[model samples]
Target: MFPERLKFPRRPRVRRRLGLGFVLGLWFGFLFYRPVAGLRPLREMGRAWGDERLFVRKDDDGVSSLSEWNVTGTYKGAWGFLDTTNNSSRFPDFKKSNGNSVIELVSTPTKIKGVHYVQGVIIFHDVFDNERTVGGAQIRVEGVYIWPFRQLRMVASSGKGGEFSQEDDYILSNPYHLLGVFSSQVFQESPRDKIWRRKNSPVLYDVEKHCNIEFAAQISRVSSNQNDGERDNYHLEGLMESPSVEEDGDCFSPLLLNATSLNIEVYYNKAVNYTLMVTFVSFLQVLLLIRQMEHSNTQSGAAKVSIIMIGQQAIMDAYLCLLHLTAGILVESLFNAFATASFFKFVVFSIFEMRYLLAIWKASRPMNNGEGWETMRRELSVLYSRFYGILLGGILLMYEFHNYIRPILLLLYSFWIPQIITNVVRDSRKPLHPHYILGITVTRLAVPLYVFGCPSNFMRIEPDKNWCICLGIFIGLQASILLLQHYLGSRWFIPRQILPEKYSYYRRLDQNSNHATDCVICMTAIDLTQRPSDCMVTPCDHFFHSGCLQRWMDIKMECPTCRRPLPPA
Candidate 1:
């Protein structure tokens, strides 16, 4: 908030020119030079060019096996198991490659740590103590979430292409088996191991819709071949994803590219477009205000201008409406955009300013105050200097740096909406002059709603932008008008009378003559009236003392003699 004593900055004549020149240069560079150069390399790197498949492992050798897969897609893989025993034992194999997963979450409870990338082979045991270890399987995998309580229970189905039934499936001897299996097969092909790893080897299976496959090593265990520990459970370790990992010839990088590009296209683009629309609407609004003030109109002329002004306002209102409706999309992406947040501020502040003007007008009415006027002055000063200051300033800052405070703004809106509704209900009760109410009702309420309801309104933009400038202009106008009104009210005389005849008896008195007279209102003799000049006459052809007349006017604008009210002229 600016201090009460703030003076508008007086920029040097050349400052504006320099600012415009700089902006033009920057935009020109962005549009012509940098944009093309930045995208040129991307063009040559054909969209279809990508790495083949990925691996899931956890050591130096296994890590290398998964590196090529990381070049094309991004994932986080984890291996955890649920054993079908009296107590149902579970183990989490923490081997990893591409440590960061596609789904990122920071949560409570260890089991729900979500997916992570890995490459490895494992064995599975049947109820008869027959162990099967699958080998030479190229693995590209991530975390396997087991609903702790539903570890053995079939949680859900992928609905892709699979089925399970109790009829013929009752012959299934391996009822104590794992589902929701993770493997590198989805991203890779042609395992170097031939005897076990084949496309139609029945490795991949669907149980209740989940795509899963038994590791090649698991089958070996069923054959009872005691394999080496390292060979028995293979694993690999790799990179943890971070911003520094710029796009490269990798699977993960390409997926990242798609996500990043989509976000920019949806959010930033809408912001810029909304900002432009706001500028245009603000320009039109300012123009309309100027025209309304300067143009005197007959019914026909007013109709014509009203049509044009209403059209422009309608367009702006429509865009504002759309911005409100799509707030989830725009705000979720980037909170602080001028279009998404500050534009609403513009609408709100504009309404407040209009009300402020009306309040000032009411305060300035001749019948409303005397010493009571100072109370109003204090009220207005406090209202504008603090509450309005904080509101408008916060809005301006929000518009400029919306992304940083988007979350805070969303929270604020929850509170602000109710407060606004309450205030609207309270302030709608003034006995407004007919003309004023008609004008305000038409301009403020009717037009905004109509505009928003219109689909093709001219002010339509992804986010509303015109709000900040519009709000500033409104505040400025209100303050200026209030100051001017104060000046005029103090200077202008409505209807007043000055009585000279009431002091006629003391006209002859002078320092040399040493004469005196009686007070006209009280008719009290006093030697102090060397020349009674405090008398005032009314237009009613009656005379009264200055003090008497001031008191009389305070109570009633009527003559003491005939009791006729003083003419407003």
Candidate 2:
């Protein structure tokens, strides 16, 4: 019903692109956000409350402590089995009730004598395991935070709660939580206290809860950090000091209670930064491909690239793509961060690169058979099967021997092996571009370095300096060899005695031989006795002027006379 001139075109592609860009920009903006703006109201409320409560305080330390103790907001944590099988086995619902809880510290810590405590309030809600809460229970939390100790000694009692909120109650599995959950930190002597242990310098805490049963917990501060995260990062460790012996209920078994650092912002930032790095590097690789494509690369240098190495890289990029895609679907922010990077990665990295790599490989391979077309297709299929079979086998190996991931990675990065071997075997002349070698080596190393070297990477894999150094040296050595081959000939390292006889194009015609023939390329030669430099001889017994043959090979890498393959000068 709309007028033809006024009707707008529905360009779904453009719309989608714009929408994606907007979402990515929004997430990128969030990456730089230090503190959440939503908490400003709560912080201000705490300040106002502090102003009124300050008049009642006598000690400066008490006043200062109260000001920092604005623990009135929401707290997220869960109960899980703490791997200490001997103790954790006691919890009946340990596996099924491995769920999370959101506790709102709805009021300030009311002081009694010399300690602060939060007791007898609607503190926690919507606690779930594999299923919902069995029956309502009142959770009472009372803690004495001693500044001298930098410790939290909290005891909790339970009865019944009125309501619960199911918002963001994720069906969670421990991702990074299990990394060092069982590990202990080293003791360091601080100037403030002579006895320095993890017990003294603690952060946000831990707790234990049951749907209908009464449980008690001894809470200790695991860790606390400032400026690095939005909240105080903690390793909340809970120990049940008491239990309701009278109640017949499925109570917390092992009593391995924990409070943890929920650093969503830090996670978002890390993912975004890594995504950006990959996007930029992938783009540079595409550019290198473009430059290479511009030149007439007819005689394939597929031999110069390692197929196994390419397969390893292809699998790496494929994993990254899968990772980004899954994370994007789960997190709104990650969708924006991953989209552009994933698109560019396809151009130079993952499955897209495999097709290009294969095309070059197939073109370079000899078609010696009479029934060439069928033979080539079968060979290609066989190559594909072999490549994927190795990849599958490698995956299984990784699964079976998970502890040796570092060694597997080191082996995978040795992608340049094929090129080095090919150059030595075939004695190909400058098969790989110097820029391509350098650019790829550096870019490929970035992902591994970020995963294992960077402390704040979302993966949170511990930095291994020795591994990083070894990887750098390893890749650097490969690039150096390739560059040396480009300048000093492919078999430069081989001894003179071991080298094969190089074919001679500059063969001289002696007095006994009248080897005079016309230059097939220019159709004018017959100069047999001028000089060896004046004429060139093909392996097929054809002759041509040196300059004429040189120029002809540049256009077509085959014999002008016999139509046979010509070796690069």
Candidate 3:
């Protein structure tokens, strides 16, 4: 027989104080985390690297060819120049048996505004005579010049045996003012500042004063002893173009010649696919969360806030996932732009995880305590605003540092792994509901994958065949886990019920008892005179409507009021 009225003990003050302190500590730790090293120097270094220019030359003497170029730029393996030149010299004299002088000029113009310019490898064929005497003739390269309001008209013809003939392409228009040539390898402050103010000339002839040129024999040669036969016997040259232009007149930009664009296409594709998959999982989790919230008897304000936060994150994730997928089909610049934006999404998601943990903490505590809901909500709002501001500031800092963001994110994710595992284990010990298990497992797996399988970092330097294979395996594993969770959740993880006689003791309500007139589960009055048989009492002496008590028992065999475990049936 249970007591007609039961009194529950109050939570100790020390425990509440400890919980608050722990939450504050977590918040402070995340807020104060900063990169150990300074970032300004790294940014300056990148800008300097981007300003370096590439110079290339080919002559009739075949000794120094296109196979001698060396690249020295910030975007190392991500971009380069391609040499498509056949081994034949483009020099006019080389075409005739009697002549020895040969020369060719190739240029690729890219959209340049200010300091930012499109970067790619320029591909061209080089031909030179093997004889030192013929190679001695210098093959000069005139510095890149901007043509204001003038377009060059050029014609090309295929020679016998598919060879490109040595023909000069000239502008059809009369004398047009040449903005200037980038004369020396090193220029004063800006390349535009080097524009020569001399009289306008139909053809540029001051090769020594206005162009950076190299003799065919002097170009760096690739040693035949260093590589296997399959190695691409091509020279590498670094090129950096400036966007500065003279605002004095209108200018028709020169067309880029034989420019082969180099970008991380495979990397972007992988990133899009990964984002889609993660978004799908997040959507599924949101649905599960909503369903749980609907069926849950714990209707605390904190619980509602948690559900809302998760829903917001799911929406944001879906939007960003779509943005990433769209970027894959767009231009290279757009692709790169979204790549940076995607990192912000990851940071936001990390912050959401912290909010989620706080929500869980609030939900686990007794909501009936005298704490003000309005005050808690206000505090949460303030914290969220601060976190967002921090994230925005961090993005600016990361953009400046460029190379440090990835490592910091990696470290943060590594730290989260243990926390996720702890949460999963703790949740698993409770009632085994399908949604609960699925949610926990997906979250546990997703965090680590997000940390390690991020496309930007994973595909950074162009992975080899083995790395691609490993990536395939990782994708397969993620898919398999998802399918397994779905199957088990739908077919085998139904909630179990506790037998009434085993965990609960029945007691009839009497008019004389204080709590006998009230149902604690619904917080409604129980009319003992009208329907006394509808009252049910648990082992902890808590009274609830019979139907309500049965439903609660099906979910968990514990006293609803005191949260005490019931005796075994």
Q: Choose the strongest candidate by TM-score.
A: 2
Model 2 Cα RMSD, 1 decimal: 20.4
Point out the worst 10-residue segment of candidate 2 by lDDT: 179-188
Q: Give a tens-digit lDDT track for model 2, residues 1-569.
A: 57754455556667999999999999877853423353344235434423323223343223343233333333446654444343323343233434444333322333322234443222222232332211112244544433222233444534223232221122111222211111111111133322221243221012233232222232222243343665644333443333435354333443444554455566668778888998988877777655544332554445444555556667777656655665565555567777767676655664456865675665556464356688878987897788678767876887455446788888888888877887888777676778878888998899889877887677524478899999999999999999999899989899989887888888655434565667767777567867778888878777888999876765556798779987765
Scored by CA lDDT, what does every candidate get? 0.31, 0.55, 0.36
What stretches of model 2 exceed 4 Å from their correct place? 1-262, 293-296, 300-309, 329-332, 350-352, 366-377, 511-518, 523-534, 547-557, 565-569
Candidate 1 runs further than 4 Å off: 1-263, 293-364, 369-373, 379-569
> In the order shown, what is each candidate's alpha-carbon RMSD?
31.2, 20.4, 33.3
Q: What's the ranking of the predictions by TM-score, best on top?
A: 2, 3, 1
lDDT of 3 by residue, 1-569 (tens): 24433323334566789999999999877544422122233234434433212112333235533122222111112121132232112222221121212123334443331111111111122222332111122222332221210111212211212322221121101001000001111111222222321132211223223322211111122345643343323222233221213332211111112211122343345455555555555555555545544444342323323333343343344344444534433434335545554544554355444545455445645443467889778766876676566556654664454334344433332322332233223322122234644464455356334534443432222123443345445444533443443344211222445212223345554336553356777888875444655777666666677788766654555778898865422
Against the true structure, what is each candidate's TM-score?
Answer: 0.24, 0.58, 0.33
Model 3 lDDT at residue 145: 20
